[model samples]
Target: MSTARDVPETTGITEPPRATGLTEPPRSAGVTEPPDTPGDPAPAGGVATAGDRARPGDAVRWRRLSRRMLVIHPIQEVVRSAPALIGLLFAGSSQGGHGHIWSLVGLAVMLVVGTLRWFTTTYRVTPQYVQVRKGLIRRRVLTVPRDRIRTVDVTSHVMHRLLGLARVEVGTGRSDKKDGGALKLDALYAPEVDRLREELLHRRPAAATAPSPRRDAAAEPTTPRPTDQPDPLPVPGNEPGTEIELAALRPAWIRYGPFTMSGLVTAGVLAGFVSRIASEGNVDLLRIAPVRQVVDRVGHEALWLQVAGAVAALAVFVAVASTFGYVLAFWRFRLTRTSGGTLHVTRGLITTRATTLEERRLRGIEVSEPLLLRASGGARLIAVATGLRVGHGAQRGGSMLLPPAPREEAVTVATRVLGTSGPVTAELVPHGRAALRRRFTRALAVCGAVTAVLLGLWRWAGLPAWTWQAALLVTVAALPVAADRYRSLGHTIVAGHLVTRWGTLVRRRVALDREGIIGWNIRRSFFQRRAGLATLTATTAAGRQGYSVWDVDLGEALHIADRAIPGLLAPFLLRAGQPSDGMDPDPGTDPIVTSPGA
Candidate 1:
């Protein structure tokens, strides 16, 4: 149970001498000392020989991936497309002729591609850069500087686990491309993957110095170290630096899963899947014994009662399924921050995953509360970091700091991760009443349009009378939602952070570092202009790129922008009478007063 701190630091370990493989050019036939042998000492002026300067292991060397990759490649390719392959076989059998031939052709093509990929791709690790050379026809070499490497991710699926192999992905935090700005080396041995990760992430010590030939070896301590000296206690893998366990999945947290919209989405997908299967097989789902029994039982009830019962049943089923999915995905979840400034998250039941997020790339933290979860005092925390793209595979949960945790816990985790003691989710500045009016008006407009559509259907398309009642109920429900949305809209500047809060169904409060803000965008639509409101967007290199503070007064928006980053917005601000850089505008006067359209 010894931790990293319990492990004694061993000292006086010398680095192995590097091999240079370098030799000085043959000395010109000249006056004095015979051409210096490799062992021979220095020239005049204390000049060191090339052999003295050459560091061994510093050369760029190309290395092919593990040979096992050749076999794993086609197997993985086939596994990834197994569903499609099965579908193709089924369709071919049904069609009875050339379909089977086409399926075979597809398999052949896949095998050929996998073989070519295994043969053509090669990578090299150098002191300055990591280089990948790939392609069969159009040769390409991709070189990423060592300093630019942001994240090193190692992943292993079931097949990889069984074979003791893993995939290594190196990400640079730039997500402008479809590949999520990553260089992938697939199917490396597990140990090799770990070694590569360590080599890439290890920080060289600043005090490391090159070996000096001038130093007297005899002056160094010659006393032989005792071989019997006890080796330092092994550090626990999970205990690196000052590790703090922030949160872990609990059975109670599963209840929050049902409150999310994911349940409804899952239900819809399930319904669609059943319908597709039934249609394809020419089977009547309603004729199924259970379905028929349920239908018959519900048919005796009143129409309204029947609809309500079905809706309730669907909701219950969805909630249960969502809860189960949450459990399956996060059975043993743990979030920890290491002293080395990396956030380590380990989760999953069947396929355990470990993700590392460097603190230096983290720009902010977001606290999200879905309506139902918020009502139950639960919220989720997400990190707004640069390298962890929000939607990439395996990385989808990379930003998630805490999942459906208590609101209080979420706030606490945010504060700790952000390295600030200030109110992480407090002191939010509210929008003016005009924003409320705008929201209410927009809600009413939507309700009115729906009602009009329902009435038109009833009059011209013979729709049922219940449509009118449904429209009325929807309109009534929208009012409170609009009011809630207005209440949720707010922004605040605290301790060099710009916090923007908005949304009703999924309320999000983001605390972004003010220094990370690269630019500001002021947008005003015709309606927003008339309402004297504008949306100010802060653009950064991390997390969604641009986050907006919506529906604030125009003057207030400018003021916030100016205060958030002084010189950036001041040049664009219009002053009274004459344009002056240093002069402060009168507090009573609106400096940029003009028409709403302007």
Candidate 2:
């Protein structure tokens, strides 16, 4: 048994085997046999030998992951230096020669710290699993069991491509919030990463020693099939390639352009703008300029020229920022799939990031069709998962799988990857009377504030405003209530999902699976009692972008309340002792009785 005490000191700490001058012989295409056993050890030479001889349930064979290493984007070197670089540039431009003195100290500290970090970071793989342990002060040790491993993503940024390195992210399901549970190993040799992935995926399943099915002599086939002909098919789960086709590739369009390009650009532009802003002395050209110098250079007669020059400079800054943004966003976008059921995503202009999500962690699917994308017949798909934030932040992360795909292709991918069919159908409950009233009142408050601000501005400018801010506010305030009365929508649970749709101009349709909901709150006010409406807010553990489904009929609220707790609590109680059936009995036509936390 591999116990904690037996864990070798070099387990995840020692450097990996150095790459040998090696190459694999080419093979002609055909169906290939998987390793016979899952625990088959790796060969002494680089090529992994898929296990074919071991019995099922045997101890996992351990083998060092020794293959060519790859590094992530080299630009990460510059990106990591952003803080010190900005400090240096600021010091150089601001304090004449004095700032340069401090800049040297800053640069020295950064170089020492960064170099130490580079040498200390390390990762390793064996037949059983992949392990990563790094961090100078708060050391982190992450071990992902091979079976639990879902996706292995390898990414190469421009720098990585140049240096033949890649960043590898191995995603297990539901990472712990505090620890950043997902496994990350950066700047590894590319070939080594690929070999590790192959080891994870290809090492043969430990062959089961279980007795084979017996056949009567009379029942056996009279003769074997012709040598070139196919053999008799094995039963379900008996054979590997019997039914599985290499999971079809996500369509080409989805893998390229759109989401990939957009994500890269967005991250790039952000990184560039942040780098520039941080580099300068936090100056905003729009608000502050070298006014005295500008006036002196062009002379007092051309006053407009000074203002124009300022505007041009701002424009130039924005233009340069956007270009850098585009370069970063579209740089080296890639999406690939492994033989195992996992999707890999990698791309970055500066600091590279890779993400892998197992098919099982996927709870719900969201397909977004922005106007521009819709017109171009392109759509983006996002998977709502539990625990992990979508990605870097709420805005970009929730998407485990993103490939700009056409509408039909997008829907197809959703079905194949998430087991969802077509678009999720959700009931649209229009904002109820109280809810509408609240929206209208909120709108009115906003309008009132705007009207007051405009009136003050009008006085200050000494100009008569042509628009009636008061009237505009009132009309806007009244629209929600009217929209509710006329076009109000409400929803009901359909096939274990809560469908919510509410909005007039910017319509939104959100569908959340029942299992995806982890928590909820239902509230009603005095005014709501008279209107016969209540608010129900449902919460999901879906990554960091927690979802909320709110404001529906009081009857629906009650039904949700009735179902939520019993359903959630039943499984645990069953594990202890079977509970009575009434715990979550279906509520037939009549509204369910109100309950809290079930």
Candidate 3:
């Protein structure tokens, strides 16, 4: 019954008392277990179920995180509580040094709280679930089923690397929700982290079904990874099969960074900070000596020249900021695959991230081409997978497949990742003339309204005639944009994926696995109803939760839905000469069903 091998610490394990329901296990000095209530409901943090307690037959050996955390935690606490500490310092300064004593007291409190985490937080990988018990005042147990595990992200920041530790985040189907992150181990020994990640992702279910929790303090899970299985990550030597080199960072790609417009995010943050400081100090930015000098010089320039100069200055600033940000974020970015049926992403110059995505969980990918990036022949790639969110501007979170690079490199990487160029490069079927009309009418209508408002202002509000003149220029500008939007509109079924493309400024082309779709939604607007066009939404339990195919011919939309997930809308569709479920059609009200399952 002794399962501990090369794990001297777990060798001294004693099984938990069944009568108490996971109350506490034997621990070393300075380690304390949180009190467990037998009949309480599970806390907000997810544990499989309170009822799934350890059985008498199972051995639950609780273990602590890396002792180095005793140092890391306090530093993290100080950083998180910086504002509060600063406020206290100010108050103490105003209170004639009484704040010094309070500051000392605050430091003591942080030390106690930070130290307690090393004692109170204990995790265990049981046969059925991976669990972490934390919190001193409000003891909570969080867990996720090993069977449903979707991803295992092992990250090591600069501090973590220096400390020889790494954080392990376990992602499951349910763990992808907003309330996820319940199953994370802040920092563990680097060796143990790798072992746990390997075991969790590469072991067979039958191999680890029996819970034998006797393991050393720094030991990995006892479950051995199947030799036949591929390594989740392509380590230097233990690669199971020939590693397929997908894409790697090219030094020249840095030139494309500025075109990504990622600098706008930095500009926004700086602008907000400047505005806050200006407001607080009651200072006028325009009144500043340097600003005034520039203003005076510009005031003498022609309007067009002034505008051009301003634009040029802004562009230069953005380019510099964006290029710097890009270098820091994707310094050594790489994407690769293996015969192991996994896609790996590793990047970051300072805070390194190594992510492994099971090819099985990968539904598809999205190719994003922002206006500036597109104009510069650059693009980025994001994963569209279960339990992974689509990252917003500048920050890809953990879903980035490729950083902003040449569009050709992006497409090449995407094609190899998905195992086919048909989904990545295939020409999509165009939506009919109705969609073209819909796209243009909406754009023109908005432009017309703005122009009319400006014309009225010029006529009655004593505004200069230039107001209407500018509106006319805008109306002229709208035509090309409207055409670009129409050109971006396309959809088709490629291989087993439902390919969709739409958008203008930040264009996204997504190729989603049809098998992942759970339901179909058909939405037709008042104008769309008249124009005989409908937007079909493909609902899935994955990225974005829902992907919409906007502005498609109503009949073709239905056909696409049927083709995507055959018979999903069969029950809700109208039969020739027959009403649908006693609901009349064409009653001047558009028919829309949100996720009508067949």
Candidate 4:
């Protein structure tokens, strides 16, 4: 793993002889003299040449590759709709005296222009950056530094695969905009794709000696990459194919509960159906409008129709649920650790995602439990990484990997990937006596409001008086309180980390590294303070969306704050989180230790 940068400080490794293929033109043509010895290439930031003059072979190679460009997609995309294409033709003919010639001529001109433009578009790799050349009428050149390139993804659709080609997308810390990238090479051969990637990564020997520190840092950074060394290999135990088994799947109910798209679809359909039924006198026998029309045309309304509709809706719901489950759970499902202490993950359905995370990026580990999951001894495990950006408008890039895991399996997996970290400890925040009163009061208010609404509706519309809505209202109001009680969560501060746990029906455990925390806030509304409760928020460099907690006990919260804040804020306060940027330990507190270990 001794990169060009890592050339021994004591004695540098001599460069290998220049490859014959590299010495012909650019370097030989008066730019500079070749190394006295054939070997000994310059290192990063040093000038090197490949002969002076551009060779005929280089010109041929460039032309051959550039000529392979097939089509410019944006033009096709804009005119792909059959109706739109047809309308363009019709509109042209209508404006041009209704002759078919104008329409035909317009289409031919469009195709020819598009093809010519496509032929002009070219993307190339230079040692320092990716060069994009495009435009027929107005030539344009765009360059993206290799290090700024965050993701290099290759994909093939049926047509592309049949053509023995794949599309390569380059994402450069720009997943924010709708079109968040600079260049793409569609219809490139597999070998070419690999070569391009290697070149982009500075993997070629010529590239090896001049690796850009910026690109190296961006690709798989921890701290700032050393300005003068080759990439380092992984520590002994972590290697590819080490086979990190995922945490076991949470219990079936929890696994398939709240977060599953199926649940959302089911709830949505049910709500829609209920609303429609309550509003209209009759329920549609079939959700399919066309089918419903046909059935109604035949004057059919029977018990069977209602049953059929319910069955059809159920089938649709299941189909949607199953598809979504597979997409979110199994999409690109791969687990691998590179030889360089990097955890590589590639997953996603429509837009495949790839992440190469340095082990050092991990902040802590999180195990989540929904109500059903807690009951079933199941938990979803997530690695809380320090440098990951979350949510839209995130200032950085990286994401929390959510893999469903069984409780026991999750613990084991955490031990393996996260390196011997103890459980988080924070002060307990059990709902106090007043919490009970508050919960009941909330429930009563909901019930009273529901009764008033129902009474008013019944009087105005002469609608059937049903006890079900009243029952539903009562349940909705009480559910949260019941859930909160069951969760009876607690938080603790320990050894520079915040550990949080809650959820009676489904228990969840989370740990946040104090070093990774970006900012802290304590909030208490009048009602919350009166109830002797408050919420504590913790932020990280990633962004604001989900980096904080919502509610915890005020007393426990303060104690946890006392232990955690100084360490969390020390980063901003004194540039503390930096590897070499150290700070004095928090004073006047017991060594931060989890309650169990304590």
TM-score of each: 0.75, 0.58, 0.79, 0.58
- Per-residue C-alpha lDDT of model 3 across residues 258-348, encoded as one tens digit per residue: 8877787888899899998799657899999999999999999999999999899888989999998888788888776744566767787
Query: Model 3, 543: alpha-carbon shift in Å?
Result: 1.0
Decide which is better by TM-score, 1 or 2. 1
After superposing candidate 3 on the true structure, give the runs of residues whose Cα lies further than 4 Å from its correct spot: 1-58, 95-97, 175-177, 207-243, 277-307, 391-394, 461-472, 571-598
Worst 10 residues of 2 by lDDT: 25-34
Candidate 2 structure quality by residue, lDDT tens digits, 356-412: 555445556666554445556665566666534565732245253544556666666
lDDT at 493, model 3? 92
Candidate 1 lDDT tens digits, 481-515: 99999999999888888899999988989888888
Q: What is the C-alpha local distance difference test score of each model?
A: 0.67, 0.48, 0.71, 0.49
Task: Please say which candidate is ahead in TM-score: 2 or 3.
Answer: 3
lDDT of 4 by residue, 329-404 (tens): 3455444444444555555444444455545556776676655555556555555653344443111233434454
Better of 1 and 2 by lDDT: 1
Candidate 1: worst-modelled 10 consecutive residues by lDDT: 1-10
- Compared with the true structure, model 2 gives a TM-score of 0.58
Reference-based TM-score, model 4: 0.58
lDDT of 1 at 20: 33
